[model samples]
Target: MSKDNAPATLPPVKRRNAELVMLGVALAVTVSAFGASGLALDGSLPVGMFGYGIGFIAITIGTHVALRFIAPYADPLILPLAVFLTGLGLAMVWRLNQGDGDHAGAGMQLIWAAVGMLLCLGVLFFLKEPRVLQRYPYLFALAAIVLMMLPILPVIGIERFGARRWIGFGGFTLQPSEFAKIALVLFLSAYLVLKRDVLSLASRQIKVFGFRVFDVPRLRDMAPMVVAWMLAIMLLVVSTDLGTSLLMFGTFLAMIYVATQRSSWVIIGVSMFLGGATIAYFLFSHVQLRVMIWLNTFDPEIADNEGWQLVQGLYAMAEGGLLGTGLGAGRPDQNFAADSDLILVSFGEELGLAGLMVIVMAIFLLVERGLRVALASREMFVKLLATGLSFIFAFQVFVVLGGVTRLIPLTGMTTPLMSAGGSSIMASWIMIGLLLRLSDNARKPAPQAIQDEGATQVISR
Candidate 1:
């Protein structure tokens, strides 16, 4: 074809390049944080700087390279944002562990991060299409159930702090609920995609506050949402994990809203959760203590036991003020779950409000990009999956940070990528993998479609 007759197409996006550059910056910041910690704590270079830097750069750069090959058109912001959070978390964990006279926690976190990245790579390698998961919604749902149930078993269920939320085998304890969340999202997305029409159109019409609201779903239509609610409630009852329950239910409700374009589902979901939580608070001592502690954190009676963690966190945040205390100089060890639940408060104490805001903004960007991917996708299944996964981050962050800041009752939810749990890290990276794949499908150019002898053949380059 002549130059004038030749096809014209825009150049492919430089998303991978952008990710690489941002990853570099994130790594540098992590190293700088370590340096600052060392200088403040012992007046020398931080311990294990070279080893940590090498491991971080290796895993992150390798992950970026994998993305270039598998999801070249994926959103640029997700990878770097994840690395940034992980790096910051590692820094915080390392600094906090310095007071322990052992390098175990930070070292374990690094190992977990590596394992998580490997899982992410495995996802990219195996899951050719995110929509493929829609074919087995029931399977995913069952897996989620089993995962939730595992921690309640008598033999392997390991109890800690009055809750059996972990299962220990072969000396490595695992929190199954963290990974169950992905399966739950998958099942919910697939279920909603198939039922969106019925849920949105087949419901009884209801008007409230003089405005037409959602149509009440049929008993059959309501079954799925009911099951989801029951499962969340069951999880709360069995594990006494209010945070996971809220996160799961909230994600399900958000996906329902997106799928059906109905706000009533969200209202109903939130109200139901609040009612259940109120009931639990009155009936369960642990639940009641969390609420009481949240309400009266400074009470001299329980302040030494249930409220001590939060009070110390508040004191640390106050000490840091708006600018933080420089990485290694603060005492996050005074708070319980300093490396997981209260990590944000720890960061706030040392990095100050400014650094905390930076972290929050980074998280906001990651969530925004996930939502954007959902909007960009054409398939209902893919859209709902992205939305559900994205909302997990939004809800989890709010739950953890709000608890730490005393805005809400403390629950045992860990910040994604910024927490010390292996399951949380792996689950988060898996979510990133799905997001990257979905974003790739969203932004990648369509293949050529050809027609020959009543058959159309398409080829992807």
Candidate 2:
């Protein structure tokens, strides 16, 4: 056939090149943000750009190159999106440390980023197939529970910010809740896949108003959700990590809905949560304080301490307006936990409303892509796992941003890749690797094996 008359059908191409270009852009944005911070603060570039730039670029490029070789068919956008968010976070962390000294410096964050990438690489390398995870769901469930409870242990557990949510050794402290989230996602995915049929079966159909809207499930089927519900509430009470609890439970609820294809499961889950929250609100002083602060943050009495951080976040965001103070010129430190919980506010103040919208949209894209992978997967376990990971990721971002903007009670979760905590960054990266692995399986073409050989061998035998 002539070149012009050639068939339009062509083999699908791997988008590794597209990913490489986007990675370059991401690295540029990150380095530029850091440089801009220096200019805004001292009217000059940093003295150690050579070392910092080399470290940052090297880690990013190395991770990307390994991903291209290992999982070339994986969704191209996810890795780049993660890189951009991580870089932007490191830049902001660096920006915040400029005047306050390098106690929580970008140097340390770069090291953590390297560690996160390395761990992420390890997941991609060793976890060759996600289906293997489905085989040992109960094992992960125990690990998850133990990890969540570790933070409350007296010896190693360290209480900070009135919450017993960290375990430390010497100078190092880790949040087990971060790793627990991974286990929760895996457990819910595997368990739901195995028992979805029973869970979907209705013990009785109840008429609501004009339609039969509710499914009264057998108590046996209900036991799983009941256990999950109690565990969520227990974590909330013990670790005081309400955000993690909410994220974990919400993901489970979402996975149940996906597995059963039932809206009723969602209804039941929400009702159970609301009822538990109502009880907690009255019984727990911290919960009451959180609710009160959410309702009336600007009030004089509450603004001094309890609501002070939130109010400062609101003011900083407002001050940023649309264009922001141009990177480092704005003071993000005014808000407490500026590099972690209220990191969104830091982006808003320095990057502006437009910038914040871009960030939120990027997060939305990442979650959307994950959902796409879930929809495309052939295996039920893979679908549920991807769905759980995606939703929890999205819920964390929404709750944190919503809390900052007074849209909901502040459930202090780190803002995914944008947050400064080592535990959070590592966990987020590992989840990203899992998502990438899932996507690669979804996109990669299955080999067509010869069936004739088997038949001939059998006949000959």
Candidate 3:
């Protein structure tokens, strides 16, 4: 028990090397999946496998090197996890393409992956301080509104599957709502940071027989929430895009809850959502059809018609059972959107429950690390921004999984990083870049205090 025997303080370690190693492992897994899938389908390795692996390795190494210069102290697991999910998605898209003899989808997805990584790098390079984004809440809000409205415009807007949520540019289509989700999160984080004190502490209470019942914010103070709710309703009514509507509003509610830390806000938000959904259900045939399909998926009445996709997806998973039919053996393409919105089902049918669990766990870990960064953040705006981003990512996954499992009506939202959508990939990487920047700020060691000999004065008695 001598003082000299105490352990010396250890230096802080920035695990950039650890991140590079994990990225290699992630790349190996993806290449292996591609190779295995090709052999199973064609009795030989895929012709494109080598090219795909090389391209992916280049992107991964480039991204890792950029991170070393831009954000050396960022969380290590995030990039690897995102890459693994995206690779799996690309593999599945390629697998589906084999049946149709159209390689364009897979080719386009790979191109988008590269584009997404470049955009991610841009974020780290240009956005020197994440807090700078907090200054333009109204600007962000306006951008979000414009992005959401893009698909409904006459010239560029294009309708598909009864939902007008895509805008055509050249021969390709883009979903503006995905980008809008990010902008809205920024706006919400900034707005909530400025008003959290009042939202949390300045609520008026209603009393019942000497006991306080519920606290309500003032009408003037409730404007933001009211506007968000109304915007969500408008999305549903105009675009008939239930997924985006629910996602935008759900993120808003979640950010507000994180900012204010009040259960009443959540209660009020959920009540408002239920009321809006009920009204939409009565007024919109699309909403009613979705609810009916959810409730009566197996019914012969619609099973062969409107519910065919859900039924086929369920049967595919059931057939997959515990270990799955192996990567190229399942008929996942029989279900609609096998490579996009129902990607989880596609994965389940081939990889089985165990494989599906791995994907789900990867997403869960990403969210957990994001929240940890939020907790470590020193600034209120950064904390709220990180929290909102994490919650939205988690909530989007939940909405997709819930719809596929029949736990809720289908909302048709793409799974982040695991869907064959350019917008989803770009937005996912943008959020990842933001998380990396915030994490760097959170974990960077504070500047050591400097001592000046000239500043020291001797006191005389």
Better of 1 and 3 by lDDT: 3
lDDT of 1: 0.85
lDDT of 1 at 93: 87
Residues 208-285, candidate 2: write the lDDT tens digits: 686997777777787878887898888777766678778878888888999998877888888898888888888888
Q: What is the lDDT of residue 166 in candidate 3?
A: 95
Global CA lDDT of candidate 3, please?
0.88
| Structural similarity to truth (TM-score) of each candidate | 0.93, 0.94, 0.94
lDDT of each: 0.85, 0.87, 0.88
Candidate 2: residue pairs that collide: none
What TM-score would candidate 1 get against the native?
A: 0.93
Give lDDT tens digits, candidate 3, residues 1-461. Answer: 58897547443456999998989888988899899889889889999999888998899899999999998889998899989888888889988888667788888888899899999889989998999999999999999999999999999998888788999988988999999999999998898888888888645787899898667776677778888899999898888888899899999988888888777787888899889989989998888888899999999988999998888888988888988999988888777999999999998999999999999999989999999999989999999999988988899998898888898888779999889989999999899889988888888766551122123322321
Candidate 2: lDDT over CA atoms?
0.87
